[model samples]
Target: MAAPLDLDQLQTFIAIADTGSFTRAADEVFRTQSAVSMQMRRLEERVGKQLFEKEGRTNRLTEDGERLLAYARRMMRLNREALSALDDNRLEGSIRIGTPDDYADRFLPEIMARFSRSNPRVELSVLCEPTVNLVELIRRGQLDIAIVTHDDEKSPSEVVRREPLLWVTSANHMVHEEQVLPLAVGRPTCLWRQATLDALDRVEREHRILFTSWSATVIIASVLAGLAVAVLPECALRPGMRVLTESEGFPPLPDGRIGILRGHSSQPEIVEALARHIAESLDNISLPAPEDTASFDFAAMNLAVRGRRHKPGQMAGW
Candidate 1:
């Protein structure tokens, strides 16, 4: 029978996969670069598969490495669950977390499942609100932690994920080609709204906000119905939507940033654990480009979104 793989080595492998660098993985796992190299060498020999290859400056996972990554994550997760289940001092309490509805559908499932499995006794309470409201709630001690849209100058947070913010319209509609583009956007405080308007202004494109709502569902509905074009992170893209590009006259936009904010709560340990889980889940999910549009320039936005339009000041439900 084959011997079991080393969890320590698996942990290092995961770190390297997440960081995309042997050096950064060493720092993350609290090991020296040379030690990290040795661990990978041993792991390669044990598995008899070359796991990583150099891609310019960063290390890219080999095909076999990608296959191993799935197993490695599951093993480490199960290990944590087993330890937690048997530990006498396992955490047992309720923790409140807030995120915009835009992310709730795509992000919450993995995060909730991971946290619940490892800390079965802990109850998770989720709140769906705009990033601005969530930031305020965290500040007022109403929430233990919040997943928010990062704005360094406004709602400062520890950015956990980033993806391309793109222009989207109904797949069957040419709403983007209208002389005065009609838009469905968030309220005045929504960062995406400003960014959209600014991008149009920079290109001297005339636009009008035909549908205004903070709700991602509402904006998505409008876009799908061919009522208007909208700006959204890559994850929020739905099947019926087509991405707009510079050739179509849409200017480039900044990447959408998602962040974590810790509240002044008493459950520091629980809060921190959830934060780590959130970060891990985000790291594992890659950004997917729209498949319907051959001309969609995902490379321009740099890849990534969850499937909802989250803007500052807009409630997820509108």
Candidate 2:
């Protein structure tokens, strides 16, 4: 009889593919780099095919690996659902969740739907707020968990995904060619807003804030009306919006790290379960490709912008 594929190995394989580095995958799975490599070798032998190929410094999935990814994801999701359904301890507690409106619209609905189906008895209380406020709420124990965007890479949270920031405008808008670049931005506390200002400053670009709002809808509407360009996560770009690349003379913006921040107190089992579901759901998100541009030195940008702060009205004319 042949040996069946191991679930742990499958999970490790998926982690490597998601993170794009064996070292990062090892960190994710709580295994040493050598152990991750050995598991990958074992998985390849079990499947009788090479699952990955080296592309520069990163590992690219092979044809067989690409085919297996869908199956692996489905299998893992089903396995988790079965475990939750069969467990005798029915979860019954309310979980307070917070996230920025932009992310809440794009990702939370699906995550909540899956969690609701699995743990029908648990009640979910959700709030849409800025990431800065969400982090503070989590610290104050007002929220059980929060999905937030962090500018710091060393944040002590579970990083679900990282996406490059892009300067976006409406498809028919030619605002990028204006002498004084107009920006429709979020509140001053927004990481995207800070990164956008820093990037523009690095290139000595003259810009002015034409509109400010915490609502993604309002910001997008301003862009669509040709009022201004906005900085946003690549995943948040909609169909009618076009990303501005280096060719358009826009400087590169920093990548945004989406992560889960849990409250300090011991969480209820239901909250933990929901957090796990949220992480898995975010890992499965497929963001569109960012604008094609030459790579900018993120390390230098970080160093240069360190300690620089912008107030609400400070960005009048620059």
Candidate 3:
């Protein structure tokens, strides 16, 4: 009989697939690179197929690996659910999570859904705010955990991922061609806003803020309506937006680092659980391709806008 697949190995496989790098996968799974490699070798031997192909310095999933990825995710999800169901000491506590509006839309639902399934008794109070404010809230013990963008590598928070900051504009609008560039910006405390201003200043590019709001929905709307261009994290680039490259007369903005900050260390178990879920969920979010020109759904955008407008302080909750 074939050797049975191990859930641990399958989990590592999913991590490798999500991160696209064995080194990053090792970091995510808390294993050494050699150990991860050995596990993959053992897994492939058990399956009787090579699962990965070398592509430059990165590992690309082979046909067998691609087929196994879906099964691995499903199995892992079930495994987690089974474990949670079997645990006697179910986690119960109120967790205050703060995140930027843009990230809230993309990552909050999955994190909350998974966390809710695992800890049904837990109540989550989510706050959507700028990273600067989130940091302050976490410091003041108003928030149990917060995900923020950091430009420094030496920050005390746990770095989740690093992505480029892009100049975003409406696909149908030629806002970049204007004499004085119109901009949709976040508050002054926002890192994206500061970075956008700094980059433009360095290039001596003339620009004016046409719209300013803490709500990402408003910023996105301004861009979508062809009212202004905005600087945003690459992951926040929706379907209707076009990314302005450095070659297109836009200076390169600094990369944005997404990290998690913990408030009080009292609820270590609950905080750690939520943090792990956030990190894993973030890993699974696929970024838009640079050349993708897909038309965004206006219905979804309108809903998001309304959601942001009504609940300015809160992005999502369960």
Candidate 4:
């Protein structure tokens, strides 16, 4: 007879795959590293195949391991759903959320307000961080949910939305008949920054970066004054600023998408509700919509960036 599979061991295997480190996996399941490894070893034994491989001391799920990882994810998700269905009266705790700077400034409050009104008993704490930082926070359990832009190369995990990344320059920028505009943008670590550069590189476009700033407003204002062109989400644009659609050799930026990422937990009700609430909020947000002659409201709450203490339009003391 085949040995019985401990669902818990499967979870351990999946967690290690998800986190890429036994230490992080252990933290996710509240076990020691040694304990997590033991569970993974037992799981591999039961399945009769090697589940993970190492690269110079770094762990990665093997091909067979990856297939099992998907199964484990599904099984865990279903099991969590079953438990949630059986525990309808057990959701009374707080859930912490995170978002990006632009999103926090533009769209998070309303989402939180809606979640609060509908589930008054469940306290929600919201924080904002960059996409890179937010993912780390989520994996560390510092946040229960977040709205961020994590495109293909940037995302080794699940994504919630795939929003477009656009180039914005000062309305007054000096447009030469044959010169690439000087650019102002956030730091190199930003997904927007990377995507913008990648797009430019892929197209063999020639442009000089003039400056980098953490503040979207600064970038926009600089561009507004014609200091440089910056790539930003269209939602970040206020009235009167225009995006350049006819750059000489540059096609519209491609492939960067806004998305959400999460994993299964014993606390599933809050996750699902919050996820729905976020999606609904995103659905209702009024972005400048896409248009041939006009920009449409493209605001989708779940697809936007947000942060803690975000005041709809700007961060205080920013």
Candidate 5:
């Protein structure tokens, strides 16, 4: 009978195969490159075959190594089965959750960590995106649940959190004669962009997108550096940003809403649990402020929108 293989050596071998570079594999396995090399040597000797072929600066696994790679992954997964079986309800299955970038960075880590502590078997995949992308992802069944900004005009979705949108600018900006306001905008899918543009058109506020991006961090950085003004959830703003347009008359924008979207017929129980978790973590969701809503020229607006849609060339503005 053959001798039993060392399980630790299998781990090192798998790491090297996965990374395809000795240095990276060593870092991944938390061993010196030399030590990893030694482990591979031992593994090759036991198998009585070369496991890798060296190319210019890189290593490629041989046929034997490739055969071993699949086995290694299977073994590691099986090794975790004992721990998974004993996991709590919250961590028993795969729970794929999605939320906006700031929400993920700020509140989600703590929530997920706590959830996993009791339910260690549960695997979590989180997606961080702007509201538009998040909503689209949900409709496409790409996510089990998503937290998105509320659509104030329609109560068509389940809500998790709500707050006012604030007009913010870079803290370092100095006022000139005309108060040049550059705007940082999310891409075409954002409702905020439409609201901002409509408000500018109605009140005759002149502004253009100084930068357009889908990343919340990039948008915030640009605003903080005095590149442009932006509208965002009040909770997102900290001390360094300045409120540029703090009027009682600023048009009411969509509420800062987190929607709980579900992928149909898939892990509904886990999805419900995740939604409950978000609502609990974020507090009660609600509509935009009643008093802040700007008086709209509803008659004129409806005509313009319908006209633009039905008869493009005839709308007054067009």
Candidate 6:
């Protein structure tokens, strides 16, 4: 029989995957670089697969590595659950948290579920609003914690996740080819809205805001209906959408940086636990592989869009 995988080794492997470098993984795992390499060697040998390959200056996961990453993360999560379940110093308190719906849709389910399972008696109050509003609430001590779009130069916080922010259009739409591009975007104060407008201006593109809202659902609905193009972080992407590339005359936008902001109202222990859960949940979310325009079924999506006469428009917030 194959040797059972070591949790320690699996952890090191996960660190390497998360950090994308042996050196950084070593620091994260509190092991020497050589020790980290040795752990991986044994792990690869036990799994009977080469888990990593060199890509340029950094190491990239091989196909087998990616496959193992999913299982490894699950194992680690289960281990955490087991420990939490057995802990005697159980925490109990109501905590209020906030995040923009853009992230709330993709992130909150796992976070809330896991945290609740671990701390059954703790009450959770969740509010979904724009990051701008969420930040104000955090400052006013109206929320215990908040997840916000991290702007390092502006409102810096503990960044928990990062992904590409892409310009996107309906997979089967010709709206992207319009001389005057129509956009479905966030309200004026939204960082993503500013980024998209700035990028368009830098390229000297003529664009008009056809729809504006704080809710990601509304922006996505407009894109799906083929009414306008929009920009979204990778996690917020949905089917029937295609990423626009620089080759397609769409300028690159800034990275989407998600951060955690803690307020003074909640107990430190409660707030910290939720913050940790948020970071872990975001870490486990699998990013879709690089944009592939050919991957979406154009005809099917086009027919689906044409079959619908109207789509729900954006809401002011959340």
Best by lDDT: 1
lDDT over C-alpha atoms for residue 72 of model 3: 84
In order, the Cα lDDT scores of the candidates are 0.83, 0.76, 0.77, 0.64, 0.63, 0.81
**lDDT (tens digit, per residue) of candidate 3 on 1-318:** 756799889989988876779999999999999999999999998889999898998888898998798678768877886798679887887889999888899778888998898888889999998887887788888999988875453235677766666777888889878999999988877777888888899999999999999888999899989999998765677877777766678887666667888999578889998987877666555554445636643343332222111111111100
Top model number, TM-score? 1
* Residue range 1-318, candidate 6, lDDT tens digits: 767899999999988887789999999999999999999999999999999999887888999998898898888888887788778887888999999987888888889999988888789999998988888898899999998898666556787776677778888788999999999999998888999999999999999999999989999999989999998876776877877777789887777778888999748899998888887777666544546345554443332222111111100022
Q: What's the TM-score of every candidate structure? A: 0.84, 0.76, 0.76, 0.57, 0.56, 0.80
Tens digits of per-residue lDDT for model 2, 1-318: 999789999999988877778999999999999999999999999999899999999988899987787678768887888787777886877889988888887888889988987888788999998877887788788999888885454235666666666778777667878899999998887767888899899988999999998888788788878789998775576756667777667887666667878886454677788878877777666543334322332333233233221111111000
Q: What alpha-carbon RMSD in Å does predicted model 6 have with respect to the real structure?
A: 7.5
Which whole-number lDDT from 0 to 100 does residue 133 have in model 1? 87
Instruction: Give the range where candidate 5 is weakest over 10 consecutive residues by summed lDDT.
Output: 309-318
Ordering by lDDT: 1, 6, 3, 2, 4, 5
What are the per-model numbers of colliding residue pairs?
Answer: 6, 0, 0, 27, 4, 0
Please provide, for model 5 over 1-318, each residue's C-alpha lDDT reduced to its tens digit, 9 standing for 90 to 100.
Answer: 999778789988877765779899889889999999899899899989899999887788888877776677556544544454465533457867777786666567656754564356668898787766666777777887776666645324576555556666655564211345577878876776767787767877666678888778877888777677777765466545655442423455544555566667367876765665555445422222434323322232232222111111111000
Cα-lDDT of candidate 2: 0.76
Error of 4 at 117 (Å): 1.4
Model 4: worst 10 consecutive residues (lDDT sum): 309-318
Give the per-residue lDDT digits (tens) of candidate 4, residues 1-318.
Answer: 877678899878866765778999899899999999889888888898998888766687788986786577557655654665456574677887777777777777777776665566688777767777877787877777777775456545444344455665444335422276577777777867767777778877777888787666677677667677777764577553555553335456653445555644456788778776665455336565545313322242223333211111111101
Worst 10 residues of 1 by lDDT: 309-318
Better of 2 and 6 by lDDT: 6
**Model 3, runs deviating above 4 Å:** 1-4, 11-39, 52-74, 151-155, 288-293, 296-318
lDDT of 1 by residue, 1-318 (tens): 999999999999988887889999999999999999999999999999999999999998899998899789878877887898788899989999999898897789989988898898999999999888888898889999998888878777887777678899887888888999999999888899989999999999999989998789899999999999999987787777777877778888887888888998788999988988887677566445445545444454332223332212221111
Global CA lDDT computed for model 1: 0.83
